[model samples]
Target chain A: MDFSQTAERISLKFSQKGQSVDTKKIEAKLRRLIEEFGVQPAEAERSVTNELAKEFNLPGIGTGGGGAGKPGERENRSIADVTPGEWVTIEGKVVAILSPVSPSIAQSGIIADTTGAIRFVVWAKANAPEMRQDAWYRIESAVIDEFKGVANLKIHSGTSVKPIVEDRALIPSILKVGELKPGIGSVRVKVVQEWETTHERMLQSGIVGDESGTVKFVIWKEPGKERLKVGAVYTIFYALVDEFNARLSLNLSTATYMQDEGDITVSGGDSNVRGAVVHIAPGSGLIKRCPVEGCNRALSRQNYCPVHEIQPGFVYDLRIKGWLDDGEKTYNILLQREVVESLTGINLNAAKELAENNPLGMDEVFLRMRDTILGRYIICRGREIDNRLLVRTCERVKMDTGEHTALLNRAGGAP
Target chain B: MSNGGTPAQGRKEGGFEREPARRVFAGELRECRHQFREGDDEKSPTFVLLPTGERSNRVFLVGTLTEKQRKGEQNIFYRGRVVDPTGTFFVMAGSYQPEAMQQLAKIETPAFVGVVGKPNLYQTPDGAYLVSVRVESVTIVDRETRDLWMLDTARATLDRIDAMAQGLTPDAARVKEHYPALDPAMFRKMVYEALAQIKI
Candidate 1:
């Protein structure tokens, strides 16, 4: 069959020098065989699958044994005699990336290649240190991890690794996108738009796209802050998945993390996953009225006792409503007087002056001079309760550079 | 009549006028001394008290009473304000009243009168300030009040939510899809479920 069109589509989703092998075609052929025979679908499909395996010189069905090759059972290769927990190394091009949110899927993940995104076990965070998407690396004995019915090699200390960074470069022929998942090392992505904060400066989520797919990325740098140049592309690495908000999500946490790199870029992954961009609205933060430390009670009128009624009293507290993000979600954060004082250089007196002059208050002044803040990206790892969602923050590494360089840094990141 | 202007003098209860009211013991010893002045009368407007200082989480004091210096009356309330690091609270007092005098006389040297009246604030002509709380009968209380307040405060501290990790849930393992599979609110809802069990 002329699979040129199918191959081309894979190229758009995967990468340039590489593309995913068309699993759909294989499945389709297997289904046809099943329909033609009166036997069980699994039985008919396996028989036909075995014939194709021989033609492609693929490992024969149930070759490695001790473990039975039953229906829905792992294929026991006869020659390589490996156990379920045993680690083995497979040097292959990364077929497909789980698209930042696949680990929690089906209890593990599936990285497709000329083979298909297979279930791979990455038992710990440190395992798959070098096996990024679209890159060629030697994956040692990653258990058979499954996701969405697909199989992949799991990364673990028990497993092995070595980087052949440019497996994409080694391939002599043009590759389609579908075949590029295993090859995902780093890919250039454009910043489409970022989600603004309501309570204060923080990011909810961001959308970026490439020729392959478009996906959403959440931020907590500052709710209403974090300016992004539209269409600015950067590289992304090692972002996997977890379950979030009832459905699955591309989690950029401990297991899966994303970075934006300005220089080189990679491609997309998976047939069903579409990288879509989102334009979320900005959020709001509460403004506070400040009081003078020594003379504040006069305004309160009722809080003053007999003594202050004679001499003059001054002083008051300031507080406001802010926002925090729980992943790509938003939350309300209460900015008390102490927190405000620490965050802003202004003291109680200066803030009062700012408040007196502007009806919006001191925070508004900070917002107006926002070039110094607001848009700055921050690392938010520590989690706190914000509104209802947990607002998380960690130390972020920020660099003074052009939009181009900033994105490049993010692109070259690891989990 | 605690807020009704008077020095620390007299008690109308069964203790009845208890002794005519002495000099130091005649008036209530005020904790927030910032409100007192020499030439003030028995009345001031209103005032506010933020839950600040040592008693931060427990007290929110706002009262209406006479600042000794208001109405240009000469009174003896040496101090007027209490600076609870959280914020300052003002106290207004003068000489004495029949009821207040009763308590002052019975209590030993300068003692605290757990205020029963609200707060009163008065703005002076020269931009000075006078703040105080009307006095009520003093009661001696202890620890339980403090604990409940602390509990209320701890309850207010908020926490954030992240999505579920692999094997995070004790049960349920299903093949996850990235796109056609991404459900944004599901994790948030899961967090709510977890939070439901927690309370102060």
Candidate 2:
């Protein structure tokens, strides 16, 4: 079959799903195409077959050089064909996309077409661009093959792809605004709040706003932490639907796919809100039991992830995610590790020794940031952390109840 | 003996439609040989489905077949499987005669028949807790009996659909009129409604 036909077959299989399609079925179709495409390399035959299966180091289907299945299979064979290695063109609509995960980069996406959902590896790394999530596209001359028995079709430099449409148009879905809780991939939101620092495990919290609504988005300890700014809003290209506390929330886990290079230039007065510390418990001011940043394992604590097992010195720091009551509602914030260490001049090794010597030795640390963090008004900046609107703490702050009244006024989009 | 040459029929108001030849169900019956007390004079019937004729279709052979003893009082019982489209259900007989036992022994796996008996439904810890009906008066009949039953079932199914389709249907209210105990006749009408919808 020709490339346009191959593209159409795969796209159709994709739209049938009420939601996303599975990855394995797509790969199989690619394998069928690669194996079935090349008949007798007569100039015309080669061109037609090549449209179905692009050149790849990956094993191509062995049709014994007789040729990919006759042109008749085009009308009959679904993208699910068991044909081992043939280049057969397939196509369809992009009804769904996979939440990109990686050995490769952040936000690796998968697209689907008619014949079936073919798993495609995007060598074309980019973020949520002008395209719509459900937009239809035609990928030309992409190599189709099986990886570890799974059929995978990939688009790289050698592959050609074009977003398809009619009536002076391009792209799939019209980007909407609302509180995005993850799966709703492309959205526009604003900075609602930010927490200082929580777990020694870096985590940023914020609320994002959109036209339809606003919801919390969280950006976790992604690769590039320096990329965020407070009070700035921009388009969030990709986010994930995840579950936490039995409820759904959006997460921006892969740093690469947290694509909006644009930031909201919006800002507000830098004030500190202070509240009385409700409570403090064990591990409050404890020394850095975890290994330093370069250090893989926790120096003494078990709360760290296992992937960091063998590294150099670690960046030992303390973090507390606590509630502060300014006489009304209680809010949350994360005090950074460095701030915790700076606030409490004790180094990791010394703190550990002190903690071991006296169980409550770390009590002083929480106390310093307590009142300042509690009743003090924290300077607020908006940033999307983990696909959320976070009030990044600029400085401890508090505004007069009357001024705070005015603050609530702007929340509704009033000037 | 019209087609496959077997005798079985579903229950209908009218009696068997065919001449009573050497009907598979014709024979002398037997009574329970054992008895025991069952909770303040109330006891449960113990009839195993398809028992190979309780030691071969005879409850009282001049000579004893085996030294096995049963325990139940007040009712003469027999047990067998009744195959239906919904699946086979184990049936019991509280007052059937030895002829019923003889018929059961002669009947094959897909036998069709009309039976009568009070049902006692209970639950097992596992199993979907499905109710098993115990059938009595097991008999073998001719093709005419089977056809009559199918026709009756088809008619009954139609009545139910009509009643259900009614704007002023008194289903539950009419049910209470016969009351306390469900008049199976009414519910059986529902079963017929279910059957008639199936394509022949």
Superposition TM-score, candidate 2 onto the true structure: 0.29
lDDT of 2 at A135: 69
Candidate 1 local lDDT, residue A241: 31
What is the Å distance of residue B98 in model 2 from its true position? 80
Which one wins on TM-score?
Answer: 2
Each candidate structure's count of clashing pairs: 207, 122
Off by over 4 Å in 1: A1-60, A65-89, A93-143, A147-151, A155-188, A195-205, A210-214, A218-231, A235-238, A241-354, A358-415, B1-200
User: Which portion of correct inter-chain contacts appears in model 2?
Assistant: 0.00
Our tally of clashes for model 2 stands at: 122
